[model samples]
Target chain A: MSRSQQLYEAMILDHNKKPRNFSVMDPHTHSSHGKNPLCGDDFYVYISCNDTEIEAISFIGQGCAISKSSGSMMTEMLKGLPIQEALELKESFLEMVSTDISPEKKKSLGKLKVFEGVKDFPARVKCAALVWRALEDALGAKSGETSTE
Target chain B: MLNPNIRKQFPVLKHIENGHELVYLDNTATTHKPLRVIERMTKFYTHQNATVHRGVYGLSQSATDYCEEARKKVQTFIKAKHEEEIIFVKGTTEAINLVAESFGRFHLKKGQEILITEMEHHANIVPWQQLCIKHGCTLQVAPIKDNGELNLEAWKAGINKNTGLVAFTHVSNALGTTNPVQEMCDFAKAAGVAVLIDGAQAMSHIEVDVQALNCDFYAFSAHKMHGPTGIGVLYGKHELLKIMPPYQTGGDMIDVVTFEKTTFAVPPARFEPGTPAIAEIIGLGETIDFLTEIGLNNIFHHEHTLLNYANIKLKEIKGLRIIGEAKEKNAIVSFVLDDIHPHDAGTILDTEGIAVRVGHHCAQPLMKRLEVPATIRASFSMYNTLEEVDKLVAGIKKIQGIML
Candidate 1:
């Protein structure tokens, strides 16, 4: 019973209903479309950055609560952060949510630790990781397969 | 309500997963096997494991008999004219690809059009699309009404002179809309156009008579009808199959091998190349027996009852809306709750040991027509209980309370 928690938590649903920075990013430096063709979960991640810091980060798309909330919380987390640290954090977040990690390792996630619950839900890990995968694409860290500009 | 006696036959129905009774509502996708079907398959592998039509030994003869008997069962089940009309393929997809290539190459020309409905599963749509691309033929879609019913007038008009062939599903897997196959077949027949029906979703839920429908080709999967995977039937008219070239070549389908070229076997055998799924074919025979014993009419009535009960209950939920409310539908129900995505609802329901399919269900065009990205589908089967529908209603409420 403890393995599964309220996945559509109040926070996730609120974020879904009123997502932050959920609009087309004008004059963006990088953008990528995150799509789960299987379930029809689609989102776009946009980033504007200087040499060291991300000046702006936003997203726009339709998906389940996990996907939309991931985008909403993600834009809030990475905005105005150092580019290198943000990329590293994105990597850690993806790994933590997709696979099992110790509770001690889970603590490193801070507020995003609730998302680690997705590890218990194998099918939903993709929903939580979709925006980050797009972020990884926008960061120029990975080659985007279905990227839109 | 399902007969308890019938429910007990399916061992998986009594299964306790995550400490909750399993509520299976994704029967359209595939059904759980009964004890009889499972045992029949086991018996084939344990004793009658041998090649067909080329055996000197006694064991091989018995194996051949079972496989041949399975083919006869299929022929009788669909009411096809002869055993030669039933060609075994991997599944419905392969069955359709055979006709798209074999029949398309022989009959279709550059300007000819292949008519299909918008509600068809990808299996029925893609093969024809490939055939059209290869043959430079046009692939046309007959539109479905907002309520998921096919527009009869449009369908009638679509059978113009240029239309060489028509194909559609017996039932919409995504919407649960049972298309009037006999009436549609009549239109195609009137135009002297060839016709094919994808029966993957309909075989378990309804009684299919290919002769009555008079379709040139009918495709269905064994797994959908409590049989094993990797085996299905393509029911083609004897005259058409006899003239049509083999879809695949080599091995069992060959008459003789020579350096220059090889001759192909007659109908059924001509299309079935290489070693077939023997155990699966035999299991399909047992599945026919199982269905025959329970009767298709009984199964159809039971599922329709469940569908009605579910429809009334699901409509009571304020935000929930059933996607397809076709005047004539059975077994399956697709719905969306508030603004909640189907996947989120699926996850919540899975925790309650309820199995419901949530996706575009391989019918994206229908989703576009319905104006929904995806839907939560609860398809019923004979073994499903009334209480299970109540659990589903409760699960929908829980999703509303949590997410809305």
Candidate 2:
């Protein structure tokens, strides 16, 4: 098998078995629903936030392994970050998933760089981006707005 | 059976990927068009393309004649009672929506019910759901048997005096199960309910006779049947179409425009508003001619043979489960590997130059009932062969070997 396929399998298995932050948040300050109508992948992410930090984060819904794992990883990354920092992380994350960022810049992406492999499979990119898009929507980005870059 | 050389007609079959021959199995989504259909549309745009039904010149007359001739061909292809009963639209989705807006809005009442089967595509389900919601009616779905066949007993029990309409697909796109549309239509007729059969999946592989089936409405898209996109046909019973109100309001459908009021044209022209898909419709007519020349019965039999060959070969693999096993089915085979996700299977097959569809297939409710997230679907067209089925089996084995 190819390296891309091996990485994808590992990603999917990890997502299915030990999904990160798979729970509900109390006193949720931020919540958003994301749906991929084409594949019927739907999920909601809840983030409990204070002025300077994210107290807790959780996700609830069903999707493919790529989506679920991506959401899990995102929740872990967002916890303890300030609201502004989390928002900036979202931008860097989007840049990492979509091509056009330099290799040196991408090296700074950390664990989120696991999704760089998704660029080869265009259809699966939506799976990885679903949760991130939901986070943007929760932050007041209008519906139907897509960040293709 | 179609000639083996028929594979050469579709240019996309020769498409090479990763230094391997492309084995396309996604026909249920859309069939690759034959070069004849492409050439017909090209000739129309290049030599004789013009606006239809308005100008007095020769080119305008030719365009109008071509458009109307396509309508006549559609009427004959589906065996509609009259040429006037066939209304050209944008595709199957638009056709169903037109029926819901015009017919459902005009006739359906508060206490009435719209009966549908569980195997319907979303295009068949959503429009009626919207109509029922808008008109204060109930939408009831008939159950499917474990083998993916519609529960005829449940269908009979669902139909009552309060049932206003019955809409369903003639073939399940995901399962490939062929529903007994004629029998269902007869039952609906006995209950005084109108019947609409979504022929999007069936139109390509099977011969459709709207008059023989006695369905109130039959909808299909041209692209599914080796024709150009943006063109479809909706065949309605003349009496029902005459009674239903116009769907869209625009020029060409009106007979006279006075300051006080306007008079509309007949049934088909009333339903068809704005400039129609002229070149595409003309290409659909040529596609119909091509199918007729080759014969639809030959295509149906050829696909059945291929389906049988695929079923027998696929059953040999251990830990593989075919989703739907209806006895009366067309050329689609949806299945799941015990441990592999459908996306993984599709990716592996795609790497081997075999294209298959993997997802809910626009039937989320059915997916829920079947108790699976998704299934890998390999649908066949008339041009496919037993060798391609062998390739699919080989691909499945390769996927299993890797995953297990």
**Candidate number with greatest lDDT:** 1
In CAPRI terms, model 1 is classed as: medium
**Per-residue C-alpha lDDT of model 1 across residues A1-149, encoded as one tens digit per residue:** 22334566667778989999999988988888899988888998889998899999999989899989988998998889998878877877888877876776666566776687777788998899899889988788466534211
In angstroms, the error of model 2 at B267 is 2.7
Per-residue CA lDDT of model 2 for B1-404, tens digit only, reads: 57889999999899996566999899999898999999999999999989898779999999999989999999888888799999999999999999999999998888799999999899999999999888998999999998899999999999988899999999999999999888888888877889999999988688888888999999999999999889998999999898888899889888898989988888889988899889999999999998998898899999999999989998999999999999999999999888667876787788788999999899988988899888999999978988999999998998776655
Off by over 4 Å in 1: A1-4, A102-105, A141-149
Candidate topping DockQ: 1
| TM-score, second chain, candidate 1 | 0.98
Model 2 stretches astray by more than 4 angstroms:
A1-34, A43-61, A75-87, A134-149, B400-404
